[model samples]
Target: MGRSRSRPVRLVASDIDGTLLGDDAAAARFRSTWEALAEGERPLLIYNSARSSEDILSLVDANLLPAPDYVIGGVGTMMTEGRMRTRMEAFIEELGPALDPAAIAAIIGSIEGAILQVAADQNPHKASWHLHDAEQERIHDIAARLRSAGLDVKLIYSSRRDIDILPRTGGKGSALAWICRELAVDLDEVVVAGDTGNDLEMFEMPLVRGVVVANALAELCRVVAQDRRHYLARASHADGVIEGLRHLGVVR
Candidate 1:
């Protein structure tokens, strides 16, 4: 007996950086492949990433890739849709007023392993950081302390160096889950792809299938390789995404 290929998925949600956008040729392939997907599988197309909607639109303007049906931006802090690329006001507002970024910075500032991100990189609901390699343990201790203090924020770290403080329940997985419910789409209909630590949540979601690109950080590969739901690609960047789609039977 052999490992079975994945069942065809009805929707594809993918990360942007090393997963989709790359060099000129890769971008062209991705655009053509995705357009074919729109005509063939006709699966829902979504960009699930750490970039803000504004950031993503810049890429669209540059002709790097076509606009996705849904933009899961800011590591899922916001979602936007339609030709106008408007933010889903009701969904973002649901998280309530964001805590002051300075408030969380005050806490991380004292932590030995964490360094706060720049102001431009900060989001109302997300506090970004860069962590020292040897401080993984201290990072946990600090996060626990923050939670115990009832700061009620979730810490998302990936690629070993990046960390984000988010509302306890707001994240890529949670946002994607919300999209499914709002569209009345079944969990089994969705498949996800990514290339770094931040994307772990998308693959970890019990309801979705995971596809990892070849260029993913080694740490990410080690963590996701054991999962039965994940498909590790043979190529890098957009080529890798195309490989996963084929493995999933999304395209011939």
Candidate 2:
């Protein structure tokens, strides 16, 4: 295992599903690494995931990933120190009338039918409407249509099966920047690692260094190549995370 020799990491931000945990082996290894890092060193482990805070925390408790000091969930529209309900309420207040529950519901409702059609056509095994290649392209088309209708919304591709629709102004990168400012930790000192498209915002930050793990999509590979300083691991899942940590000199 690698540990930082010169500059100890102040914060370690990572995505959950594909980058850190993939199968049982990766989950075990990631849990071991996280537990080892948790005791005494107490470096903040911020789980920046596309999952909701509730879902992320449940996974954390189940797999016993390091108890996250912070969570940036819902593609970064929501952040939670511990409990999500209070922070969510505050965030909703800040959103004001622009993010009324009814408007968001309408957006979701509008897409429900198309999502169902895609699901029926592709994955009959899955009941819920999860994005796939065709669905994502359609979602983009929907966003364009919404924009033309005078609604300002952004459709973000997270995983192959997950798309988040949000106000055009918010995203994971914005959330990371906000956390960095609050912690007084220079974004240059922080590191982010992830495996899917949702991780793009965190990778693109000029102030932050990033690693795209082996499971990343082809689109992400192109983006990572554009920035030579951003590292890509050869290994997949937790092994990839370990390799990335070594690349950053966080572990050896």
Candidate 3:
């Protein structure tokens, strides 16, 4: 449903979980497409995921997916070059001491009871809390709680099961912007692919073109459809990602 070409892509940003490795079939296809990229033409893979950096790295080690040139972890609250750093380190270095972890923790703790209760009731294992619409209300409540505590926190929707709480000033899109600046790559040159809401901010950026794989949720599909350059693939999961990449002319 899209065109294919042999042009070299400089940078590729992809969401993990549902986008690239939701199931074995998808994972295999994603791996193959990744492997097919010519070494010289291989774009730097930016692994953006809600998973903690440790978990993300562990998965990379276990699955043998090519190590990313950069990893945006904790829903982009933390970033690592070749290896990850503590969240405290990233916050301090990037935004300065204006961000207070203790204050943030206090705010989270204040509403922790309600959030946990709702999460537990929704899923005993707390696996599907993000899929609940009520979770959005909780997020808004949490944000208000933080603001009242003099801590600015941004509630970012990243996936069905997760929402990122970041210092009001930063998020996945912010991290991507930083990477683009560091690499001196124009934002328009980057192609972002993801299957969930967390990837929403990545698409909103002015310089980036987002491709929402076909398996994305209805909410995400609506967002992707708004952009003329954004694409909706006919495939699903890894096949969808490959299709989107091929559409961008990153693959032959």
Candidate 4:
């Protein structure tokens, strides 16, 4: 959906869980490939995940993942950058008012099977939950209930288990777009990777190429299949990401 693929990649953003994790060896390979690139050729790296900024940083500290230039965390409601992990104030300000988790909890209190995620997963702008085995109708009903109650939010159901309620304007795609605008990077020059439904938003961005790891959830695969700009790697996790990057000519 973006311009053309002729532009050299200037940014490589990926989800942390199923897209870039799971295989230590593959993670090492990705790190080596990324580090091997000449400094001027290296793209701005970003890790976009449903995880908290601190949670993602811990992985970097442990060497499980390469450090990122920026982190789009909490399902895109929060962002932080650099070693000190400074909060992205402009992004936060653009997200408008934060949604109250308590208010959202009360609204969905009576919805059967809608269990709130742990406090660690909850954030000021994201009211997350675990709705495993719940019917799509039921999940939509919960979202409907909240909207009917006057809350302006978006419902992202991913991994067939997670339900993240974020501000209508928030999502990985929107968050990445904000970064591209701020950094003056063209959307066509940004490549994204992920493996779940929540990661769908990033893939949906117009003109942005994407990699859907082989281990990705079916919900994500079905959508990516329709877009030829996105590559579905045969390998899983980090290896899949590397495979897609090579296929897209973003890496050797």
- Segments of candidate 4 deviating more than 4 angstroms: 1-5
Model 3 lDDT tens row, 1-252: 556332345888888877877777777767777877777778888888776566677777876456677887766666777444333354336733344544554655454332322422221101112323536666677667767877655666544445445665466777788778878888878888888777888888885777787778865787779777677888877778888887887776
Give the worst 10-residue stretch by lDDT in candidate 2. 119-128
Q: Any runs in candidate 1 off by more than 4 Å, and if so which?
A: 1-7, 38-41
Q: Which regions of candidate 3 deviate over 4 angstroms?
A: 1-8, 83-92, 98-113, 116-131, 135-141, 158-161
Rank the candidate models, highest lDDT first. Answer: 4, 1, 2, 3
- Worst lDDT 10-window in candidate 4: 1-10
- At residue 44, give the lDDT of candidate 3: 85
Cα lDDT tens digits, model 1, 60-179, are 778798767889887878889836788898778766678667667778877776787777667888788888573567668878878777787888877777888888667888888888
**Local accuracy of candidate 4 as per-residue lDDT tens digits, 1-252:** 223356788999999998888898999999888878787878899999999999999999998887789999999988999467999899999999989777788976566777888999988889888878666787788788888989999988887788899999899998999999999999989899999989898999988999999999888999888898888889999999999888877778
Give the candidate number with the greatest lDDT: 4
User: TM-score, each model?
Assistant: 0.91, 0.79, 0.80, 0.95
Q: On lDDT, who's better, 1 or 2?
A: 1
**Cα error, candidate 2, residue 93 (Å):** 4.6
Overall lDDT per candidate, in order of appearance: 0.79, 0.67, 0.67, 0.88
Model 2: per-residue Cα lDDT over 1-252, one tens digit each: 234343556777888888777866876876777667535664577888766777778887786565777887767766788533235355434332444334444555576443532322211111123546645467678667667666666667645666565665566787777777878878778888888877888888875777788878775777787786577788888788877777776654
lDDT of 4: 0.88
